[model samples]
Target: MKLFQKLTPKALIFWTIGDQAGKVYLGILGNLILIFAIFEPAKINYARVLINS
Candidate 1:
C-alpha cells in the first residue's frame, strides 16, 4: 500500500492516459496486445519496439 502511494503520482502523470475516454482507449490497446501476443509468438519474441516521445 505504501509502495502504491509512492508510485501513484508518477502513474497518474505518465500512465493514466486521460479520462473515461482514455480508459477505453487503453483497454483496446491492452486487448490488441493480448491478441497479438497469443497469435504472433514469434513476432512478440523478436520484434523491436521503439516508442517515440
Candidate 2:
C-alpha cells in the first residue's frame, strides 16, 4: 500500500505494535473499569486503575 511504502521496516513494526496495542487496551481497560465499578469498596473514594509496576 502507498501509506505502508512510506514507513521503513522497523518503523512499520513499531507502528503495527502501537496500532494493535491501542485497540486492545481499550477493551481490557473497559472491562477493568466495569469490574472496579461493580466490586470496588464503598469506603475508598479514589481511582481504581490497576497499575502493574
**Which candidate ranks first by TM-score, i.e. highest?**
2
TM-score to native of every candidate shown: 0.43, 0.51
Each prediction's total of clashing residue pairs, residues at least 3 apart in sequence or on different chains, is: 0, 0
When summed lDDT is taken over every stretch of 10 residues in candidate 2, the lowest stretch is 44-53
Candidate 2: what lDDT? 0.81
Residue 51 of model 2, lDDT score: 36
User: Candidate 2: where is the Cα deviation over 4 Å?
Assistant: 40-53
Relative to the true structure, candidate 1 has a C-alpha RMSD (angstroms) of 13.3
Model 1 quality (TM-score): 0.43
lDDT values of the candidates? Answer: 0.73, 0.81
In the range 1-53, model 1's lDDT, one tens digit per residue, is 77667776767666555666788989999999999878797665556443321
Winning model by lDDT? 2
